[model samples]
Target chain A: MAETTAATKTVKFIISRQDTPESKPYTEEFEIPYRPNMNVISGLMEIQRNPLKADGTKTSPVCWDSNCLEEVCGACSMVINGKPRQACSALVDKLEQPIRLEPMRTFPVVRDLVINRERMFGALKKVKAWIPIDGTYDLGPGPRMAETKRQWAYELSKCMTCGVCLESCPNVNDRNSFIGPAAISQVRLFNAHPTGEMNKEERLEALMTDGGIEGCGNSQNCVRSCPKGIPLTTSIAAMNKDTTKHLFKKWLGM
Target chain B: MKGNSYFARKLHSLLGIIPLGGFIVVHGLANYQAFERGPEGFAKGVGLINGLPLLPLLEVVMIYLPLLFHGIYGLYVAYQSNSNTGRFKYGRNWAFTAQRITGVITFVFVFWHVYQTRLQVYMGKITHEELGSTMHHIASSPVFFALYVIGVLAAVFHFSNGLWAFLISWGITIGPKAQRVSSYICMGVFVIVSALFILSLVAFRGDEFNEVASAAIALLGNIG
Candidate 1:
């Protein structure tokens, strides 16, 4: 194959950058030398290589978060062109020009692209959204889930703590303390486990509290916005059933 | 079929009992009005509503008859839905179950509220002094207020939640994805409505209506 001399095009990015957590955000434009197959992160890297603004002023290299640049870690998730998504896979060729990148507004912006994901972590803790595995060494061959249940649960397990579901969610604003769909889906995931079932009643009871599963309005946005395509609303609906059953069981002294 | 056909009819059918549902709305509205009107205006509002021509007779029919019908029908529907939902494995199914369960709780609360307020009003057992009493009245007594608070909360869950599910049941919310978005929105609404009721109760309990209202005003004023 004859190697063709390829021309590089300039790709523009308008990023909302902040120096510190308390600093006011401002827009910075960059015209990165684009390669044919470059992704958003690669373009960002090009900017990082030469931290000069389009207006010809030297500035600090823009900061962002990224890991498992294959879009699995969800560390690089942001709002690209007004949509919450992973930046690692957001290709320069695919997006509209002057690609707008901002931190997902659902969480507090830690510096620039980094957000305080503590609310999601806190919600996971509140719901006990984990298998109660002890660190006394591996509990060797723990109780297994039914194949059918495992299939659904495997879907739930795909959540990467990416805040996309929460970002698209309307209920997760500062005024309210909704735990968001990811946590709710996690509740379903943990409660379905055999070991997780031991705390099933506890998990259900936790969800019964204010800002628990009852906080879900069934907007169904999380399922839609999920990049890994986790079935979030299904988990919510399943957890709802579990909580109700738990409530009845408690009421009946069963 | 998708836009406001089936569930709207169901809601309309439910709304037809508004004579009783009206009392629920009026009573809740009246109680909430205490936040704005204070004890005197609330009392006047109570008296004015009560003083409407043939209101006593209307109260007997509108209040009790619809109460009896709606209460029994709600129970019946709850029972039927419960049976129909036997051993369903879905979360939405559970949400529906919760809605019915909340409906039962609200029904019980409404029955008790009538016992304390509506029936008491009819029997002339409630003095004018007791009329405009705030959260304590809604909460009623300490023991009763606890139940009332939970019940009002249950009603909040039932109505707001049921309405959301009702949207789904009618197919207004299409697909699993959009349904999820709506569910999230509905959850947000649940938080908001729950907060409003919770704040209202807490304010009533603390006898801080003026303070709460002022805070709300300041908050709104700030927003503006």
Candidate 2:
């Protein structure tokens, strides 16, 4: 029987790197020791430890953003193998070798795999994607929601603001001011809430503004690209109806 | 730049489905009459449309104005968006890009078509009876034939895919199942309409219409 050596088992990565946000991006290759069930994040961590290029030259460690190693936290979202997905959950064994790691270009690159997600956050704020609750002192028992409504609401609530949906969207480029599907879905999520209903009209009105719901090109990419499988396009369609109704109401002085 | 108002976007989608889309379907079916009844049937259909009372008003309101708004606003919307099919190569993303690209090609082609056919008629350079022969004159050339072929395909795609997008945008087809069904239906519409339009083009291919075209040109020369 032939003996299998661990030294021969290695994973290759072609990482796009930028030393600074203002600097140009370039690719660097690295070969890391392969481990069973390893992920892109694990490979990145290995690169961080060794800081060696594939050609045996010493180099700076690759930069990326991550918090929870699991997929819940959206910080580690990047283009892995040309798909915008969570780096934490991308298994090396499942991925074809020479794994490509690049920052999601929809946003401005902070450096390497880390991108500035301020545009997404700005969109979230524009839509007021939260239930406004004032007074810190013991506000007991907010309004209850029906079980079915809560079930779907929980699904919408799973959006980690990871910017994957935006990254995959065509309308969310530098020239366009479209708020994107993620923020629009958040509007639907908050609008469905019992307490969030208080600001429902406000949210709808905000969506009627520039870069709001009108920005959606109905590309339907957000729903497909969402790692959490959030029904983003459904929310957009619903909001399209709501915003139209709101516009009619505003015209009628209702 | 600030985007269109919510009402404007709604109107854009609405106008596309209504007067414009309705006009394409009607015009396509009218042209399909040529396949069964030859060029004379197509001429009669054109004459019928021309014979309507206050025809210019109807043309401006139902066709020209709505087309202008939809086309110009569509151009604006297309300009404001970017295509990311290179990164996210989903079916819907590709359809999105196709919709925009076809919109542009259709816009240019529609303008040329109107100028060649309708404007000439309005200017009294050609009569309604000469419509089939004029179309034959245009289509007999390899270059114009290629242009019409591409233009017709683009128009068919734009209208069909725009129908699907309209259903989703208006919240008519919210779920994946409904969207899938509507997509297949729209594809059927595209194939049928495109076949009919191409058939009409082919109907005008022979030299039989050239005699009528020669007479029309002779009349124009005398008037000039």
RMSD in order of candidates: 17.0, 2.2
Over 4 Å off, model 2: A1-6, A136-140, B1-4, B214-224
lDDT per residue (tens digit) for residues B11-84 in model 2: 88999989899999988988887776886788788878888999999999999999999999889888878988
lDDT of 1 by residue, B1-224 (tens): 23422222334334433554345446556655555556555666677786799986886777666656656655644543321133223466556667768878988887776677666756876454454442354653677667766887787676656656654433355446766687787787667666655545554654543454455457767988
The worst-scoring run of ten residues by lDDT in candidate 2 chain B lies at B1-10
Considering every candidate listed, which one attains the maximal TM-score? 2
**Predicted candidate 2 versus true structure: per-residue lDDT over A64-108, tens digit per residue:** 999998899899999998989999999999999899999998889
RMSD of 1: 17.0
In the range A53-89, model 1's lDDT, one tens digit per residue, is 8887999998888989998888899988877899999
